[model samples]
Target chain A: MQKIILNQTWKGMLMEVKRSSRTKTAVSVVVPFILLAVMIGYVFGPGSELISFGVVIPEISIEKVEFVDSEIIATVRNTGPIAVDIVMADINDRIYPAAIEPDKHLERFESAIVRIPFEWNEGEPYAVGLTIDDGTRFEKQVDVAAPSIQPTVEMITYFAIIGTYVGIIPVMIGLLWFPFISKLSRSKYKFFLALTVGLLLFLGISAAEEAIEISSENLSDVFNGVLLVATVAIVSFLALNFVGEKLKKRAGASKLAGPIAIALMIAIGIGLHNFGEGLAIGAAIVLGEAALGAFLIVGFALHNTTEGFAIAAPMARTKLMIGRLAAMGMIAGVPAIFGAWVGGFVYSPLAAVIFLAIGAGAIFQVIVTIMRWIQNEEGKLSNSSVLAGIAIGMIIMYITSILV
Target chain B: MLTGGQKMIIVITVVSLGFAGYLVFPAMDITAQEQPEVFVTHSGAVVQTTGDVLDPVYTIQEVEFDPEKYLREFDYGEVSQLEDGTTLREFTIIAEDDKIMEIAPGIFYNVWTFNGQVPGPTIRATEGDLVRIHFTNNGDKEHTIHFHGNHPAEMDGIFEIVGSNGGQFTYEFIAGPVGVHPYHCHVMPVEEHIGHGLYGVFIVDPKDARQQADEMVMMLNGFDTDFDGENNLYAANTIPYYYQHHPIQINTNELIRVYVVNMVGLDPINNFHLHGTLYKYYPTGTDMVPSEFTDMTTFSQSERGILEFEYEYTGRYMFHAHLTEFSEKGWSGVFYAKDNSQPNMEGYAYGS
Candidate 1:
């Protein structure tokens, strides 16, 4: 009777374990999509109101004026909602072309230390005025200052941190291809190729939205910006088609033909977008939003690791050598360092918009290429799997952005 | 004698804490103190320089009472303080027509006025000053300036009348009883006289109750546009939708003294409602002290009161007649004040 009772107790314990395991599997599948659906719902909700719509005109003012050696540098900032482009500096009625920290970009909330070169005595006082494109003028009388070197010790320390992370990290993330590639299998690799298209699709939409929002004050600007975006998308698609045809003819159906060419295109497209991102990082640092800059760096680094996995997925079937993978990584990621170096000195609003537009166009073409490939392999893999993978890819990018 | 390890630990902890505080702790922003440079305005009121624009500090003139740069106005002078040792104050009250004004959309009224406004210019005087008014009638009507105050029967404005267009008369009195009083045409059937916009306020400021503040005059009156013997619209300062379209902007935490008078013709009584605020009420300004601290106060016809208060927070606050019908029609405005102590441009929400 004692033996029978002990056996029954063991049987009850086994049944409880099986029930809990089933619950764990169910949770693992449902929770991620549920959370993501909620976020997407909020984003698309009708009542998601904008806080301000560029009603307040940009009010720019010169905060301080100083003489660094013979050059008169004025510290200027915008104190209003809209960004104003500095057109001309009328120092004591002598007009000069306006110069900014990032040469042509009129960044919002960012101050520019403008150096006005003019003949001046050490003890003399001079009047300085700035006029914007809209004919608003800011004038101030400033006394001469003792000469000193700019980019002070404190600034130098800040530049060092920016230089390392914004420049070197993307390259390091690219080189992570070898390690991540070792884990990719045949089926997982094909899914990733399709999945990458979805990721790019999200980015392309995001860039287009940003392009519209930044220049959407007047109706004319909105019309013009949308026009430019459409033009770039069509032009890039045609150019890529022509190049793919030429490459196919030269390679003569080698295993590396499609995968290598597509991977390279993805790298170039992401690199262009990353250039725009680098500009943002550099601007955030110069604008004294260091905490924002730091957060952006961490987020971008995590994002770059995904780019490594993305490039690796394409190269898996070819048994691509480690040396070639490193080279591919450099091509994809080295442009970020170059982008960072120039971001501080030369930013044009038009150029920023153009680069982003081109990026969106390039990424859109890559999606078309992947879709065409999926059409050739129709019904080989289940449709639901591909769709699920695409959804998962877009959700990851969205979650990372909101997390920061 | 401290060991090397102990010294290193102490140094590292202090440095770490200091760096963390520098990065994490927000800096407090201190509001700038107003440096009032006295520049008495040459206008309908004695205004001192109350704000600074920049280095060469000058106040921005309130748009309502910006004085005419050139002498286009017919014989107008600013309200000024009496010269030292001078015991008399003087004024000129002209009963004229101010063209035609639109009370609401497409609704026009040719209002008979005193000094080119619906309500006559507010007369401010100190106690015991010999007050004199040179009254002129520039309208095609029989009118007289019957000011509300203590005076001899012969010098009273009701008994002494100015008839026809271009009529002239002089009324004199000794300023007494420190209180706010309503002055209007005392033509028989007072309703028509006040309804046609021939009314104003005369403020006799108490000598011992002097307080330095930004001062304004708010006259509550109704307009009889249709002449059906009832008021069609009400206003705070003669103009309907004036305050709503153009808010009275004052600095946060500055004392503002508003002299409110109710001269509504049809309405028996109307109240002033200050949203999200309270005021120290001085009924009729009869005493040097206040009667109550309240947010809403009512006034009957010809009853005036003095309210003194300062806004503690920064935002746009609506002040109107508590009667929703009156507020919805016209009698409402907003007071906008900016808080200077916020370190960031955080008040405005630009959706990011």
Candidate 2:
């Protein structure tokens, strides 16, 4: 009976082991399936709702404010990625029935004029608020609401005067260093040429950087704005190179013509750079974003003086006629006037990108030309004086740029 | 003797394999199911199911849209007499690009629209009428109404980009060509404009009108909800499977005229097919005479035509893109034809 009990115990042990193994096998299969099912549910479930909340981002930029005969006219542009409907306009937190010229609806990059007959005082502070269809309000405050200046002859003259101070006068002042540069030795001449190279290089790099930033930030993607900047820069570089090469080949026989051609190229490059600066200043005034004080003008004047020095360095040894020098100065400065006119009257980001790109390309091509000329004069590059001149030139530009 | 570490490793390997098998096997099954299946119909024509369905993968409350209303709707514009004794049709179309619409079930898309709806409005006018479009762009992007017909350079819509945000442009021209054409935003990157639903049918009747029939507009359009350049969903108006769910009702033996416009972007070509009957097709509706009698027709983007047919037998008929992929992906619909002489027939109710 004891033997029989031992056999039954062995059989029971065997059955217990089999049952536990089956349970383990079943768990191994089912647990993974359950976990996977849960994962799938989490990933492809209503819980992961796409675009759950309707996102409405309304943005409007108040470009200009004007007071015209008991009426407050505010020019606004829709700067957001979405369309905005202007439903109401308020003056000093009080709602007013405003007439929106054209339409109340503004698509992205579209502008509208809002006219509110509020009889606002000229010297009093007033806040203008525009309510979009989404209930988001954009407010612009005029600390002293005054009659805004329209783009008239006086405005054009004002822009031209500012451009002269910023572009021409300071450049002419830098050209006063011409006599001193002309007295330098051949080695010193090479150093000054390298200095001009440094200055042009700095200008080229900064212009390219600004063009890239503006194209990416301000312009629409449909324009392929960044690519536009790159393509325009490349195209301009090739174009200027072509023009420079043609000039160099035409004047290859005359030693005087070489310096004059280089000076002309330098003037064109500086002019393009000055044009971009003028566009910025003009656009700022038009948008009422700039505080154009005496300090700002002086700072710009000081900054542009370096550009004149760069142009003068290339023409130091050349016997240039006064008419030619005057012409070169105008070439390097007069574009500012045209730029200001375009920017004030019809400012477009695409135009800004293209002009800046052209400036950068011309400046870079001038650097290449100057380097080749230096190589021809000095038999080799990388002297201590040349390096020091480049360093000093860059430092001067950096210091002046800070003031601006 | 096996170490404890080895036992643990074995257990982990077994579990991981089990998990992988569980996930991978189903994925393989789904991939297999995605293959198109061919099925021969009773009429001896082979039809294939593309296996592309409105697989939402998630459920949400459906957005309401009436395809029937849009199908037959035509905007004649405010009609008046011009100073030259010509009929003047003035249409004020508002363009908006910031409209979020639920294109498919639970699939919302930011669609650029005209007067708040996709495919805009069907603009109808008699040939030689002075058609003036007072276009206002209220959207946050540049837009312009470019009519696909004979007009002056300035009225061509290209180069005359109307600004966004309360920008206005008056497109005035004499309507001609005596057929159906598409009018859409002529903005650069035109595909994005038309793809987002900133397009509509412009139908100009001949000097002499044709026989009056049940006229309807069937614009074949697609939506790329993911912005991937490839279309994910397609439909006869804007909604997929809408007409299938609510079949278009018509009287038997009545002349049915369908003004079909294919504005499906991204895909190179699309086609239309009718089950149970053939119809007379007029390519672009330019010619007065029918081009052919066929059960199917092909179309490139912006291609349109007129299809005229009469039902002899009263029943439900299927109309869809002949391309199986498009039809499976929400481009399918049905037409319910009933004899008016038969009174109170069971299951003959509209949309039944």
Candidate 3:
């Protein structure tokens, strides 16, 4: 009877141990797989999304809006079946909460007359908008409402930094690679010079085309812009020439001076073009087409990456310091931020014409200087290579433009 | 002072370092410059003064459609007949702008789509139906719809079937498919047109149709954020994580049929894999019976098939590319069985 009891207890203990082991094995296998699946989702989920997921979205519209005394009376409708919470309305530059509650809820196909106490100026066209809490924003445009031109602090920051992001890349690459390029013999350097000059000339023509096309609606505007461009080009040419001669007299070496001056002028020309780009982005954003604006930023960022090559290629023969490159980057890229600020706030076709014209003219002047330099080198560079480079440059620029 | 070999090594080192630096620069993103408080003038000029002009860019305006919402299968119009007893499927494919969608968790692609959805709205018709596609270019560019199936030349969307900005074109054809067919803009560069979300699936049922149960149209596609002639994103039905997040719920005993089309342009090949089961696979929609019964299927560009199967057990079944690399990277998803009780309802669309 004692042996029988002991055997029964031993069987019970073995069974319990076996059960516990099975659970441990299951947990060990299942937990890691679940974790692995989550980790995979996290890594592959967001970055570089090739296609978008089609999800049902809530569609909201401002049905009716009017200012009553110091307050604004607005009717917003949820056209879709989703309930929208925390809708905020914008009047002028100030944002007024649309509802009295902590959150505004609009159910499916529901209408809510949100009495937003908006601060408005008498007789001033006020821009109005209503936004749901889910990051969906909408603007109500009245005939008397003025266009919104003031940029938010974030936008200003975006413009300021985007220039460096877009404009610094190519120039920095060129600057860094200059060491290897300088190692090339004199004849090879001439070919490089020709390629650089060809690229610059192409850019000059592009700027010219933009200036003319922008002012195409008005002949007088075109004439004024072209005249200004020509005048500025000649002035830059003469001014740079005079400065170069003076530097030659003082510095005792003309080689370094020529390259430095050319680099500076190229930076200035690029600055003007970048400003134009900034203006475009700002205008697109202010037009309430945020997607279009974002695309413009991306497209320009891509273009600027290549533009840096143009800026630094000419300095291949001249070794430079990082500080100078940084300064040059600032010189060329900083104007983009200012341009965005101006472009977003203002719609002056004349100003756009002027800015584009200045860029075209400055680039033209640089081209002439480089061409003259190349001619002095004579047969040191292959004219065919130069021609080929020009064609390549034009094709590349055109392709990049189309991509945008 | 250095030997030639040592000099070569130094040069190589410097070149490598420069390359490394260039790659790292974009990430470092040397913080953007400081901005000074400035005021805007009514005339559109910015000045370094206070209280000067109307504000812009800061005005919180309304946006068009929210793209973060989960995507669901959309129905255009149903099949109908005229007095002559001829069935007609008329599809209005409008190429419009400002339609952006989230392909992944936070990555969004702004696409010029047909009627506002990527892979457009799927068209379903029998073998001999008169299909009419009305194409409208409501966006900024010129576009045209070209079908990839057996159709008459005049009805072909390319070569003279072109529509300019804000213009329209109509292509009529008798729906005939050899399986699943793809329709897209055949404007000069087919890659650019397709890349911008201008393609969709066109399904034509066979005269002797197979036993129909539950059906799905899966257009295996990709998205290239940078136009480097390569796809950085891959998915089916144009939405990333679509099936994984919103599993297609089906009954356990019901036969499932999935029409898969690999619509990738840059990449050479794409594939499909089903977990826990194998199915009768028909490569190329023109086949009467499937050539193989397999759990995994591989396809190159433009290749498509009809995969048929059913589940006996009540559980979540995952389907993805047999290429494990491709499967985890946006090409994988879960299938909720007819008996699935708990559906992950995040990003679920409430209304039709």
Better of 1 and 2 by TM-score: 2
Q: How well does candidate 1 match the true structure in TM-score terms?
A: 0.40
TM-score of each: 0.40, 0.42, 0.38
Query: Which model scores highest in DockQ?
Result: 1
Relative to the true structure, how large is the alpha-carbon lDDT of every model?
0.63, 0.78, 0.64
Instruction: List candidate 2 stretches off by more than 4 Å.
Output: A1-96, A99-147, A208-232, A249-254, A283-291, A340-354, B1-352
DockQ of each: 0.02, 0.01, 0.01
**Cα error, candidate 3, residue A117 (Å):** 48
lDDT of 2 by residue, A1-404 (tens): 99989999988887879988788889999999999998878876777874456765557866556777667877777767787777556676444445565566667666666776666676688888775654355678876665554679899899899888888888888787888889999889888889988888888988898898877766545446668777767767877887887798998899888888998899998899889888777766665555763455667678777888888888888875667777788899888777777667656665787889999999988888888888887877788888888888788778777866
lDDT of each residue in A178-291, candidate 3, tens digit only: 676567776566656666666666667777677677656322321354665565455545554554455546656667766666677677777877887777777666655578
Best by lDDT: 2
Error of 1 at B321 (Å): 27
lDDT of 1 at A245: 62
Reference-based lDDT, residue A390, model 1 = 74
- Candidate of highest TM-score: 2
Runs in model 1 deviating more than 4 A are A1-188, A205-257, A283-289, A315-328, A338-358, A374-392, A395-404, B1-352
Q: Candidate 1 residues A1-404, lDDT tens each? A: 88888898777866878788678878989999999998877775567664324355556656556555545667665545566666445466444322344332245544565555555565566778765544355676754443432455664455445644654465456556645555776456556766776677777787666656543521123226677667755665656665666666787778677777766666666676666566556545543456877887787776666666566666666765777666666655655654544444443344455556666777777677666666565544456656766778789888877886
